[model samples]
Target: MASNTPAPEAPFDAFGGGAGPAAPDTEWNPTEGSLRAENRSGGRHRVVKQRSNFARSSTVLGVGVIAAVGAGGLATAQEKPPVAISLPDLPDMPDLGLPDAHDLPGVGALLPQENHETVAEGRANPNPLTVATYATDDERATKAERAEPVADVQAGAGDAGEALRARILQQAEQQQASADAADKAAAEKAAAEKAAAEAAAKADAAEKAAAEAKAKAAAEAKAKAEAEAKAKAEAAAEAERLAKLGASYSMPLSSYSLSATYMQSGSMWSSGYHTGLDFAAPTGTPLKAVHGATVKSAGWSGSYGYRIVLELSDGTEVWYCHLSSMTVSAGQTVGTGETIGRVGATGNVTGAHLHLEVHTAGGDGIDPAQWLRSKGLSL
Candidate 1:
């Protein structure tokens, strides 16, 4: 083996370790323009400046990794995912009733519903941002929705709204019908009551009128019956009285001609008129009594020559005037047709006649002819 290797020199000490003081050339100053400047002190030529484009291998790898991570963080910040919310299952809640159509302002039969199909479709993609695109206002999504043959979501909502509106209309109609029925019933009831009251009033009036008429008829009938009975009794009593007179009484003078009537106007007597009926007969004609009576007086009067007063049981006085003689004495009873006096013209007479006068008790004289007619005599 050839042995020609040079021995290595000992290392120099820079921090003053057994070496002499450092030379002025050992210090480095970068402020100078260049280390290879020309020797200005006329010393050995300035060491040539050494510069190397060098790098550490480990430091290069760390810088490359940091740059790549920063680029990835920038991209992640630009793109965001849909906000995902994990909600706990809601507890079974008590039923809180929804508001009625009338309870809300302008609700008008609208009902809310959940869109489960849209929610499920979003979850199937496993990408919240991809699913968010479906709900975006982008031109792509808007165009896709417009291209559909029939709008599914809008058609479903319209159908539900129409059904709710129809139901509301039906309910309104039912309520109106019920109200009308109630009104009609009330009106009919009022009319019936009015009719009943009118009928009752009419019935009362009719009853009162009928009762008045019946009472009037009864009173009239009673009065008529009483008058008829009174008339019949009077006629019967008169007939009985006349029948008694037919058996026991008669005309005062038979076969005599009637002369002056009672109450005849004349100036031949003192009283200026005739006061008794005159019967012209023979001077001795028999004069009979009209009825049974007692003789009250038989005497001579100035104008009557001889007179006899016969008083009947009822106090009626019968006077036989101008008599020539009287058969019955005073205070003597005589029957009907019996001779009570004789016809004669004894005083104040132009001819032989009999004058008869009838007088009621305490009253003036009456016509003998009328008195006889009352006793069932036609004359």
Candidate 2:
């Protein structure tokens, strides 16, 4: 008992999926909105296939996703240029490039390129890679400029040292020369002094020899002169004595008789010789002195009985051997021709006579007559 009612069919949208079979197992019943189905295997009726909306809607959604991804990759362009960062300069270094690459012709050359400001010339490399190296070159240039003065100062110091060495050498040479000159001068002075001393010694010896010779000659001359003067004086005194004797003289008696001569032999004489002149006179006859004389002796004698003697001034004695009496005393002065005694023969005689003898001071007898004759008187 089922009821025979049909469900209503829904309205289709262009973008929706289709609904499939609805109820179980019976047979289709066509209603007012139900569609008929076809069987392809059957001869007359076949099933109807519908155009679905899912495939078309999927194609539209895929197109919209591709458009969104392409839009994100193509972003908007920037309004301003990129900002530049200045880096610190690097130290200069040796090149580190490919071997022999720098020798390639024009490899490092800059191409004709533009900047933001337009075409430019003679400017530094526009490549950002060369910026640090250019900064290093500028720093090196500054350092080289600063070191120039110090190098000049070092060069001046070297020259000053050379000058100082030269001056020291010159001073040493001058000192050596001066020392040599001084030594030479000292030697010369010593030699001169020695020569002068030798000359002085020689002169002194010569002078002393001359003085000695002069003294000897003077002594000899003085002795010779003194001897001559003494001889002259002696001769003059002899002459004076002879002159006195010539001026004063006299004979002995007034008168006398000659009895005997000298050196005659006679027996009556005492000495056996007649030593003097004899005079014969009487006992009262006066006996006279031979010269001016002193009475030497008057008295008695042994052989002549009485005797008298008269002494002259030059020490000659005259004797009257026979006398009776003496008229003068001993030591009485008598002039020439003055009576001193009387003649007598009181001794052993043949007759009365006068005996006279002459004696010199040396005790020698001479002839009385001869002595008187020499004194400017004749006996």
Candidate 3:
């Protein structure tokens, strides 16, 4: 048999039908008996998800804390200027049917130690929630006072963070641009210096070549002048020697008219041409030694009525033919212009004349008149 009377203390079923042991009376425990019946609107109630104020506030503040910590670590590791981090906007906490903790007096002492600063100070808490169930009154008040300035600082930090990041990027770009300019300038300067060096080298080479060419030309000119001077000196010496030698020679005869010349063609001569120079004169005209010489021969010769031969110092021989008489004998030394013979009518001659012949050391005959003229004597 079932009874309609309700139990005075029934444990609340967390699941739909399960019942647990009754809790102690000293602590609060949810139970079906403590719950009140509500009027039905002819529809089942929809279940709604719920969240605590402390958990929501902690999630919002964690993001800001993590961002700040990461920025500080990056600055330390790189040894660079500290960068500002922008924190995300924290969403407003939803109303949870609970009273606002800030409106109640001494409400911070009732909140969990984790949510004490957030609930009492009416702001997000940067510190993580602690496992402690409650916070002291003094700790809440002190933390609440500190939280004001922290909020103020954070309010301005958003704008300051963006400005700082922009400034750092701008400074980096300026440094890079300056470095690029310095590199470009250095390259241009190096190119200019190289070009100047090459030009200088070319100039030096040209100057050296020009100097060498000039030196060669000067040497050639000097050599030519020396050769000209040597030739002039030799000519002057030869002329002086000939002038002294001319004084020693003399003409064969003083007074005579020239007749046949050497190498003259005549039928009377046995040879095809006359071999001697002829001087027409009186039968007894005197003949003289043409130069200083020894008498080589003085006698009658065939075809020639009389003849005399003289040999000079240079091995030259002079012959006087058709002579009437000869004053000098064979092997007699005579001075220049001394009497040696007389003119006469000789063989192959039409009238009285003196015939003269000259022979070189090799016995080759030459023109007597030309030989005499070469000794500075006039015909």
Candidate 4:
């Protein structure tokens, strides 16, 4: 059997087919490499190593998923209508560090060329490079075109929301100020009402006090007037009592000077002391009876010349001596205050005067002044 190991200097076939060696530092093209056949022996196939575009494509797809999630969340948050995105067509990009496809073996069909003969003949193969590009320059152009109008719509929504928030804050401030003003007005009204009520209460109290004082003063005045009326009535009653007593009694002489009293000690009398009351007057002065009486004797007697004796109804005797003359008989009756005789110096002579004496019913002499006073007479 032949050894299956190839020599170390042999060229590596990346496509698993016998082909020419690749140039140094050049990347293989997929459109040319994938069309070659694989070498197989028995049931085993040869393992071929080639560069793939999967790493770049997977990175682009992951970025696209993240970008899509962010865009969906922004749209839901804004809650705005979607706007169509349009962009101006960009100029063709300059090539990167790649050889011309025309120089590469069997890669001419992968690039867009000016020739359309194969396409018109319906024999052109599908180019893998132009298939759905995940991280190609053409994809970046499409994303930019869609994002322009979205940014404009988001900005407009933000401005409108800011204006609405400002208006709400202004309205709240105005309402608060109005409420404060109303509260202040209500408090002021309540205070004014309280002050007025206090003033009214004070006025009522003062009026009540004044009324009480007036009533007290009136009561006092009435009591004083009643006392004065009672005093005047008592004085009038006393005067009436004195008037009744005056009609029954009187003094013997209306005008006279007293010379001697009853029982006065002197050497000029028969008993060595005066036993009668003496009244001095001018000669012929009238003498009157002291009370209602009847004459017991009216005659001249020695040492008692020209005297008269009178007897009262109660059997009391009164004698008038030293008279100038007599004017009544022994049996004549006389009333009180009636003129009976005259005054003169007679019998036991002295100056012209009247000497009066009194005796009780037992014929015993008493003080005449005291006896007259007992009968309600002022001597």
Candidate 5:
């Protein structure tokens, strides 16, 4: 068989050994397909590169998004909007009725429009309101007309305050004056009382002195009266005693004639002297003793026929000389007016008579007139 067919050249395998599976063709070629395949491979590489770049870009974008979110949260935490504060409006206040802004208490109104600007400014923006700007004529006039009662009240209050203060001071002064007057009056009264008391004491002393003087004068007068009375009584008693003695010693013969006197000179008697009184009578006429006495001698004497001598206690002797007879003997007591001898002319007698003689204690003849006169009897 030789046929001109080329024997299957032993199955001339393009793969060398036993083929387990069919091998891919190695020498196959397609022109447009190769080109297309090369293009497709390039396209696949480009696409993978693009996919990697896109993944990196996507990761960066996510990180940037997280940072932006974190920054936004931080900015929200750090910064905040300002809060607004609101206030309530104040309420309007009611006005108190007052005078216009220019007036003074007790004074006249001020000039017109004097404090308009100040008052307006103060009302709009009152810093510190004062009373000086209110004392204006226009304001006072306006206030007086509109608010007369308020103006009067303010004025009255001011006047009352001043008056009250003045009254208090005046009262204090009056009280002080009254107290001083009372003290002076009390002192004067005390002085007057003292003076009166002293005057009363002086008057009492004067009265006492007067009483004492009066008492002394009365005593003296009483003493003088008693002395005068005593003298008068003594004189009266002396007169009575004298009268009794004179009556007892009276002479018994009332009509006997005197023939011889005492102290007479005679020629017949010795020494020519007569020492006795003679009472002429007839013979045997009785003779008497002038007073009571004792007889000391009753005998005859030379030239005398008979005689009797009577002695008295007073040292006096009575002698009956030239008697007719002697009746009293010696040592015999004779009473007054008793018979002691008889009337006779004896002892150289010229005629018949009774002779009587008085002799002292010394035996001297004394005048019978003087002796008898001493015994409260008239000679």
Candidate 6:
């Protein structure tokens, strides 16, 4: 049996070289054979395993890179500053070549034109070019085009110009009306004030005139009362004088007989002078006043114990002396032949008699018998 022949090789199995029991069929089937079988065939399978391991590690590294990039994006989102948007600044505007109201189209033509005149009238007209003007494309248009019928443009321009003019005129008229109303109101107020003042003045004048009339009436009444009082006093005085004249003529003293005359030098006294007239009547002969007169001196004198002097209306002074007693007082009025005193010889006399004397207002003594004769008395 020692023949030089290799032992018969064992039958190879697809799963493993050792055929323990045929491996059970699994549900997973691979397109390649087992790894040990393929390795035994060649190293190509190890190379393929190494390449798959490298590919798996590279996929893990790529996943880690993507995670890191995502985390960095979240951090940057949290750390970013808030955005502040700003607007651009503008420059100041410059002046452009623009005209005032005066230098535009159509306004110069529409305004009233000025004319020359003398300066004495003191009138002036506004500059026509000072009027306002409209801004429009038609202002720059040709004259022929402007004159043409451009639908509603010509009509609108004419209406607008007319409306502006009408508005200005209406405003001016309103202002004028307001001014006129104010002036009228002021004039009416002034007129009312003047009328009131005039009325007050007239009332004052009337009051003054009434006061003057009352004063004049009072003065006239006073004057009339005084005149009546004066006339009554004169009438009473005249009646008293008439009554005295009637009483004086009724007495009988004018018929008395004179026995002796005063101032006779017949040794009747120690002085050798008779000083009175001797009536030579009984003791109670009634004396008489010579005329209508006042008894001015009726008291006693030193030599003639009691005496009486009668003052006539014409101021002739008569004296009745050698009285036993006086029956009249000073200022007592008496009529002619009225009893004044009784006869006595209390003074330097030897017989009872009356010392009759007369003195004029001029202070000159005269004979009493001569004075009685001058008064139309027979005594």
Prediction RMSDs, each to the true structure: 26.1, 41.0, 15.0, 21.1, 42.3, 34.6
What's the lDDT for all of these models? 0.61, 0.56, 0.64, 0.62, 0.57, 0.54
All candidates' TM-scores? 0.50, 0.35, 0.44, 0.37, 0.37, 0.32
Indicate which candidate wins on lDDT: 3
> What is the per-residue lDDT of model 5 for residues 66-88, given as tens digits with 9 covering 90 to 100?
32332232333123321111111
Error of 2 at 329 (Å): 1.0
Instruction: Write candidate 1's Cα lDDT for 1-379 as tens digits.
Output: 1111211221122122322223444533233444235345443333322221111112222332432232233333223322211111111111123222112221111111122222222322222211001222222235555433123323433555566678789999999999999999999999999999999999999999999999989998998898889889988987888877666668887788888998788878889889998989999999998999999999998888889999999999999988888788999999888888788898788899988899998868998998987777654
Candidate 1 CA-lDDT value = 0.61
Q: Which prediction has more favorable lDDT, 1 or 2?
A: 1
Descending-lDDT candidate ranking: 3, 4, 1, 5, 2, 6
lDDT of 3 by residue, 3-93 (tens): 2222234332212343333334532333443332222334322222232445444543443354344333233323333222221122223
**How does candidate 4 score on lDDT?**
0.62
Deviating ranges (above 4 Å) for candidate 5:
1-239
User: What is the alpha-carbon lDDT for the whole of candidate 3?
Assistant: 0.64
**Which window of ten consecutive residues has the lowest lDDT sum in model 2?**
85-94
| lDDT (C-alpha) at residue 172 in model 1 | 98
**Model 4: per-residue Cα lDDT at residue 193:** 91
Alpha carbon lDDT at 348, candidate 2: 63
Which candidate would rank higher by lDDT, 2 or 3?
3
Error of 1 at 139 (Å): 7.4
**Model 1 — which ten-residue stretch has the worst lDDT?**
85-94
- Shift in Å, residue 244, candidate 6: 13
Quote the lDDT for 358 in model 1: 96
